[model samples]
Target chain A: GIQVEQSPPDLILQEGANSTLRCNFSDSVNNLQWFHQNPWGQLINLFYIPSGTKQNGRLSATTVATERYSLLYISSSQTTDSGVYFCAVGSNYQLIWGAGTKLIIKP
Target chain B: SAVISQKPSRDICQRGTSLTIQCQVDSQVTMMFWYRQQPGQSLTLIATANQGSEATYESGFVIDKFPISRPNLTFSTLTVSNMSPEDSSIYLCSVVPGTGAYEQYFGPGTRLTVT
Candidate 1:
């Protein structure tokens, strides 16, 4: 089984600030995904970047497969972004998950 | 992207009872998984449900405790048997819709509390 680790266990930002979250994996993965679990406990898909970079709205993610690491960027953060962010990697039908970074955005 | 749904969004039960959570996917899928997430904790895979055969249980899970059934490609059920206070957690179902993308979609999850 692979190991997934997320940095910055907790973060706090102003309503319009920006922040970055990092995820490191111990082994190569065939699939990598970023998810946002909002206040209502819904797991929203942020990105499915196994490699390269992708952007959606005020959020973007980059996965360096060769380096076994991924980064997620939240720009101009809003109060709505106050939740937990998760990184999961999958290989051979098994998905390994990071503990997650809990974010708080003060309005 | 696939639409996934779970039944009984939340429930409270007695310690010795059992609860069955249902997962339904709008589209056909090749792989379905069951996961448990404790309060304020990360998700842990319980088992991988195969369509016609027995499920593959993870290290800490056993079939007698958390039995799973995938009768077809679009639906599955996970039963929390002989529930205890330690079994209180959110149960979620996920699917990988073999579209060559390797992306997994999750259901909203069933929040269970054992008294």
Candidate 2:
């Protein structure tokens, strides 16, 4: 089983501020995904980036497999972006999830 | 990506009773998984449901307690038997559209509260 670690267990920022969340995995992974759990406890898929960089709206993610690390950037954050962000990695089929980063964007 | 719908979005059950959560996918999926999330905790894989076969349960979970049925590729059910307060958690159903990757899309979880 692979171990996943996320940095900054808790984060707080102003509505227009920027932040970066990092995830590190102990072993090589074939699949990697970022998920945002909203206030209502709904899990929303943010990105499915096994490698390379991807951007969606004001949020972007980059996964460096060689470094066994992934970074999620939030720029000009909005209040709606407040929630728990989870990064998961899997090798064959089973996925190992990080504890998640709790982000709070003050309005 | 496939859209997944779950029945009984929330429920409060009594001890010794069982609750069956149903998961329906808009499209056929190659794999379906059941995960449990405790309050303020991360998701834990309970089992993997395969069509026309018995589900494969993860360590610490048993089929007798969390029975699963995957009659088809688009639908599955997970039943929590002899419920207790400890069984209260969010149960989520997820699926991978096709093979080659393990990226999964999750359903709006069923929030259960057992007394």
Candidate 3:
């Protein structure tokens, strides 16, 4: 089984501030996804990046497969961007999830 | 991406009672899974909903307690039996569209509260 660990277990920043969350996995994986669990408990897929970088709006993610790590960046954050961010990685089928990074944006 | 929906968005159950959750996908997917998210905790894989046969559950999860049924490719159900307060959490279902796409999409989740 692979271990997925996320950094900054808890984060608090003012609105408009930027933050970066990291996910480190113990083994190589073929699938890696970043998800945002909103306050309403809806899990939204942010990115499906097994490797390389991708950007969507003010949020972007980069995964270094060789290094077994992924990074999620939130720039000029807004109040609505407060929630838990989780990273799930899987090799063939089963996925292991991280504890998640709880981000709070204060207005 | 597929539109996943869960029935009985939220429910309150008494101890010793059981709750069955329904997950429906708009499209046929190759894989369906059940996950549990404890209060203020991360997600944990419960089991993989196999379309035809018994489900493959993860360690710490058992078939007797969390029975799963995938009657077809687009629908599945997870039943939490003999529930207790500890079973109070959000249960979510996810799917892999397959067809060469491996990205997983999640359902809205069912929030259960046990007394």
* Alpha-carbon RMSD to native, per candidate: 0.9, 0.7, 0.9
Superposed by TM-score, candidate 2 places the C-alpha of residue B75 at a distance from the truth, in angstroms, of: 0.2
| Candidate 3 lDDT, B64-86, residue by residue in tens | 99999999999999999999999
Residue-level lDDT tens digits of model 1 in B11-99: 99999999999999999998899999999899999999999989999998999999999999999999999999999999999998995
- In model 2 chain A, the worst 10-residue window by lDDT is A88-97
Candidate 2: regions farther than 4 A off = none
Candidate 1 chain B lDDT trough over 10 residues, lowest sum: B96-105
C-alpha lDDT score of every prediction, in listed order: 0.94, 0.95, 0.95
Cα lDDT of model 1 by residue, A19-93, tens digit = 999999999898899999998888988998989999999999999999999999999999999999999998865
- DockQ comparisons of all candidates to the true complex: 0.76, 0.82, 0.83
- Per-residue CA lDDT of model 2 for A27-84, tens digit only, reads 9887899999998889999999989999999999999998999999999999999999
What ordering of candidates by lDDT runs from best to worst?
2, 3, 1
TM-score of each: 0.97, 0.98, 0.98
Off by over 4 Å in 3: none
Worst 10 residues of 2 chain B by lDDT: B95-104
Which scores better on TM-score, 1 or 2? 2
* DockQ of predicted model 2: 0.82
Clashing pairs in 1: none
| Candidate 1 CAPRI level | medium
